[model samples]
Target: MTATEFIKKVFFFEVLQGLALTFKHMVSPAVTRQYPTEKREPVPGSRGLHALVRDTETGKEKCVGCGLCAAMCPSQCIHIYTSEGEDHKKVVDRYEIEVLRCVFCALCVEACPFGAVALSEVFEYSGYTREEFYYTKEMLLENWDKNMAGEKGRIYFEKFWRPKTVDFGAPALVKTEERKTV
Candidate 1:
């Protein structure tokens, strides 16, 4: 190719093209809001974190200790022990999720047959210690309440909730109290 032609393609169009596109987005409506002050709704089914749902009807832990979520977890951040319960269902003994290792893949949520687990929109969890990063059932439930607050986020979580093949689904409440032996 001629020198001028190459310059136009490389410097003028090709290299500068990316900058132009970026500039366009800068002028267009922003997709992100400033953190804390301005929060945007999470896309439905956002795999932000792992949470065992609380059964609304019973106001208790919905997790039946099925191990489906644990089986589906790719990161293996989930740790659950099971025991016999009132209905002979496997009860969760100590449901612990290592937040530092969680990938937010939504696989566990989808794997739950009873819709007892989910990926919550509460993406704000951070920690200075490994101990702090490991979330217990209580911590997960608190995140659920915080994230599920307000109508907009709640609606967004509801609509976007869809993980397939027992790998993803919708957001679930961590409100239930009946959990494992813990």
Candidate 2:
């Protein structure tokens, strides 16, 4: 072995270097968050909990009982029941999401043509029992209500409502005047 290599091994240079680094970091500002007390802000477009959007004018849910969300769910955790109402409109009889089985892929949000379903930024949901995780329509609506209750909630909702510009490379799908005539 070279003289420098032998000297490094004999002096335990690597161990000393590691210790020096540890001591240096010990004096540095702590990066640890106090969690419950000091919660970090969720980034834009962050998907956490699920919620059902309500119509601003009528104060009614935007969901039209379309099962597109359930159909597009990869995990099949969404359950939606629809029936014809007295007003001749499809009524959402039941809407349930099994949170435990959900993969949080946000497919349901993307599939909802009416922008009814949205993933909220509230990720602190935890329960002692498995049954507690099963969120019903009322529970989901309540979640949305809680989110939209404050100014922060309004900002969050606005972020979701803002039009997003995404380009999916399928020119044939784009409807033009020529295509409309054809």
Candidate 3:
């Protein structure tokens, strides 16, 4: 062995260096937050939980029972059942979500043409039983009302969600005669 390497091994240089690092870290300000007392705010547009949007005019959920959300879901966590109402309109009988199985990919929100579903900024939900995680239509609507009710919901849709197709600016078309051949 080299003399320097033998000296380092005998003097416990590696252990001393590790101890120095530990002490340095101990003296430094703590980066860890006291989670229970000082909970960190969730980032805007962060996918946390699911919610169904309400139509202001109708005062009802905007979901058309089209099943597009169910079809688009990568995890197949969403389920919608439709039935004809008294007026013979197709109404959503049930809109159930298996929260435990959802990947929070937000594909369902993107797939909705009616702007019915949204991912809320609520990340603090917990349950002891699987049944607690199974959300019904009422529960989703309640979430929308409680968390993303007014201006916040509108802002979320405008800022985070994809823009409407009509809002896109199309390029101007050029005449065929004006095009030069390469």
Candidate 4:
């Protein structure tokens, strides 16, 4: 209606301003990473993949099959079956985690009194089928074995944000027995 408004409309002043902003960003530094080639390190307390911790002494699973992790999982993705071992201690018969249903809440990590389970930094595990996502106890243990080959004791757990009193026990001074063979 006004002369100024008419000039702006005819000249497309707002469109020019938007174009200028676009041009500015085009020449600026890229914020996105070149994924696959350059992977970014996961930030502290980032919940990625679940792994079972192995005991230092016997090179066995640290989980006593207390079923705390299964009970705490809000998504109900965790399943555990325990049976009495020859030593009279409760042993984990089966542990399965449906990765597709997991919420990555890290509650399972917090609920384990023995710190047998932890979320790792390996977030790239993807598959075409649902069967690939269903991680059994052996698969989870294999993940831990592969991911934590050279690291000294629970790396992700140490970086995880939690209370000082929440003890996952001391780190193993010696490397796992399996690692020594390789």
TM-score of 2: 0.77
- Compute each candidate's TM-score over C-alphas: 0.61, 0.77, 0.82, 0.77
lDDT of each: 0.67, 0.78, 0.85, 0.79
Worst lDDT window (10 residues) for model 4?
157-166
Please report how far candidate 2 places residue 73 from its true position, in Å.
0.2
**Best-performing candidate as measured by lDDT:** 3
Model 3 scores what on Cα lDDT? 0.85
- Identify the superior model by lDDT, candidate 2 or candidate 3: 3
Give the per-residue lDDT digits (tens) of candidate 1, residues 125-174.
67677898888988776665555534633343344443232333444544
lDDT by residue (92-181, candidate 3, tens digit) is 989999999999999988888767899999988998999999999999999999999898887677555643531324533535443322
Write model 4 residue lDDT over 2-116, tens digit each, in one string: 9999999999999999999999999999999899999887654467788888776878888889898899999999999988878798988999999999999998989887778
* Ranking according to TM-score, highest score first: 3, 4, 2, 1
List RMSD in Å for every model shown.
10.1, 8.5, 8.7, 7.6
Provide the lowest-lDDT 10-residue window in model 3: 173-182
lDDT of 2 by residue, 23-122 (tens): 9999999999999999887764578888887767777777888798999999999999989989798999899999999999998877777767878878
- Model 3, which residues run further than 4 Å from truth? 86-88, 163-182
